[model samples]
Target: MYETEDIAVVILNWNGQDLLEIFLPSVLKYSGDAKIYVADNASTDKSVDFVRSYFPSVHVIQNSENGGYAKGYNDALQKVTEPLLCLLNSDIEVTNNWLNPIIDVFNADENTAIIQPKILDYKQKTHFEYAGAAGGFIDKYGYPYCRGRIFNAIEEDNSQYNDIKDIFWASGACLFIRNSVFKKLKGFDVSYFAHMEEIDLCWRAFNSNYTTKYVGTSTVYHIGGATLKNSSPKKTYLNFRNSLFTLVKNTDSNLFIRTIIRMLLDGIAGIRFVLQFKPQHFVAILKAHGSLYLNLGRLIKERKLLPNRSNYYNTNSIVWSYFIKKRRKF
Candidate 1:
């Protein structure tokens, strides 16, 4: 059985000294014997030095460069020897006794490869966070929505989701994963860089016959958009590009038909942005499509080598359900 000491709480940092100073204490105080690590992405700021000087007990692994989330974790995780890897974000505030439930779940289910605890909003404590509210699920078109969050409609927590359940993807903000499973799956695709890479990883895990779960008893509060704000067009770009990349590489059935439907739906979103006077996001969608076209050849090649990816979606179309029919709550 997995124990507390077998876990490694590795926080991915890129010039976020302020966030580390604020949130690192709770992780250190309550983690028991689980090793805490600050995986720095070659920060020019004092992130590594500060963690080294002040939080001397916390191990620091300096990556060669700021490879965003995907490669930063890939590079740093090479040095981490723990059986269980907790990919905690710098902006997450983990609570007391968070590790035990995750360990218990891992020990109970041998096939479970990934786990995400209930992520509440750090700013609004009563509400579920947008990133991974009570775990994540994807639509047939590769759009991801959560149990407590679908599109922009986030649900208020009243002990409604405080139960263990199976999930499609666990949030990267605070994710628990088996190190052996991660190694066998070959880690996150570096092409994604950031945004939805965890979903891609989880999708691959699902295809490999491994389970991903959500244990709501273990919870953490995440300061959503701390690194990349929702307002930024870059976030829009990555979300669109990486999502398409993931859809092509992992999803089963007719890739050509699914991609066409997704792009057409995205066109509607771009028009909506135009009507809303957010032209940058519209352009971001177009650029995202262009990148998809450019890399489609390589993506298809990658998919050909992989095994059968069957029954990946929970819903046929989340866009129709959320925007058209207004089934906001998931």
Candidate 2:
């Protein structure tokens, strides 16, 4: 049984009954004594009832509306009293003793404010998942990638990254963060709604001198893109737009230069999408930029309040390195 009273595994839910039916059992079976709660985002279906009926031991926190992931967790987590908050996704399946190693890490270091478990793919099994892979890092221009994933390239889990290490960001798919730190940072930016909000939170934590880490001994399988398919135009828009917002709000230096260069790179991405006959994706990038332009003033004002860390990034240009250099495997 898990010994920690400080940790709570809170899975944010929308209309995900099928996902709960398939994945919830694994979490229940493997999570041991850690308190499990499903924070429902006003799911219209019987997801909350299903949890109540089938998994009565699992607590359910219901919100009044579907506020997406950012506000969904922000609202539900306010009710959780645990010191450590594991913000898990409903589409993830936990392995045996996954919580212990992570809990051990948290117990060891008070400075380690956030941690992400090594995430493998539920479908592929041998491959690392796209969401968080081994650990997450960002380019100098704020494009986030993982140790086992660069862009669309996902590497096989050959135990290459099987060690505890500091990471720039923790994947929200299975993020473990100190509750006090989470609240201190004001949870996630609700304006994000979803997508890249986790990165923004991690960057903020870094600015506040807290560390994010990846504990490789703890592993979970993620069935990513369940709620919003990667192919969806809306998904494309949110990702691109939220990424821009993250860059603007968190970067400590060269804000204008980096933003301009990033926009140019995004334009190149849009052109590539158009050349590939995916005009919808191109248009999605355009819409993302339009949204970013409208919200630039507020984002700039928010930057003034944040402590900008210049050494936050691990690489120069992930776009150039991934595409131009042909460096796919991480």
Candidate 3:
């Protein structure tokens, strides 16, 4: 059993009344003694009122405006004083006793700053989810992938990745982290607005000599792309732009060369998107590169202020491996 009243499970919401209605019950039912909170992002709907009336036991904090995911959490977490912070997504459904396993791991390891449970798809329970399947890892060029997922290929759950292990990054979909560490990092980079902010936070933690782990004993079902549909061009824009921001801010001394190569590779990806009759995605890549170019000087100054971590990537080039060698399975 885990310690009572030490965990604060904070869900960041933004106009997701239906999602909160359907999924919040499982979280309340299985979360046990951990305090649950709904941090609304200035949603115009009656979501806050609904929570106040039906689930008054759950705490509610309203932000002044919709600051997306990164800033929304940064603003709300200031009011929470729990030792352990679980940054849960509003679209996820928790299983029975899911928090105990993660809490046990945290209690066992003093160096573990962040932990992510096994995330499976809510639609297809047999397959791993795309946001974060088992755990997260990055390649030489700063591309993120998971243990049970690589690009578009997702592995089935046969208990192959049941053993807990140190991972490069953890998914933000259902992440557990020490409250101290979250404050130390000053939360996520608000400039990121939405995507890849979690990976950036995990990379910073690694540089600070902290460990991120995957606890396979615990699990949750996530409705991937519920907030921003995967097919939306705006989603593509945010992902591409934010990934470039993460690379520039966190990459070591070889930032110039790496950024150049990454942009070239991105060009090739844009061509591939065009070949697939997705010109909107192609334009998204171009816009991402343009934004990166415009923010180059500012990002360089930001890099100078941080401690460099050269040992960031697990593989040299996940792009080459997946595309050329056809190494789809991880």
Best by TM-score: 1
> Candidate 2's residue-wise lDDT over 1-330, tens digit each?
225566899999998999999999998888777789999999999898899999999999999999999999999999999888899999998988888899888878879999999999999989999999999999988899999999999999999988999999999999999899999999999999999999999999999999999999999999999999998888999999999999999996799899999999999999999999999999999999999999999998999998888999899999989999998976
Writing each residue's lDDT as its tens digit, candidate 1 over 1-330 gives: 889999999999999999999999999999999999999999999998899999999999989899999999999999999999999999989899998999999999999999999999999999999999999999999999999999999999999999999999999998899999989988999998999999999999998899999999998999999999999999999999999999999888688899999999999999999999999999999999999999999999999877757688999999999988999898
State every prediction's TM-score relative to the real structure: 0.99, 0.98, 0.98
For candidate 2, the lDDT comes to 0.93
Spell out the clash pairs found in candidate 3: none
For each predicted model, how many residue pairs clash, with residues at least 3 apart or on different chains?
Answer: 0, 1, 0
Point out where model 3 deviates above 4 Å: none
Clashes of 3: 0
Off by over 4 Å in 2: none
Model 3 agreement with the true structure over 1-330: per-residue lDDT tens digits:
248479999999988899999999999999899999999999999999999999989999999999999999999999999999999999999999898888899889899999999999999988889998999999878899999999999999989888799998999899899999999999999988998999999998998899999999998999999989988878888888989998999988898898889888889999998999999999998999889889989988888887878989989989999999998788
User: What does the lDDT read for residue 193 in candidate 3?
Assistant: 90
Clashing pairs in model 2? Answer: 252-308
Score residue 113 of candidate 3 by CA lDDT: 94
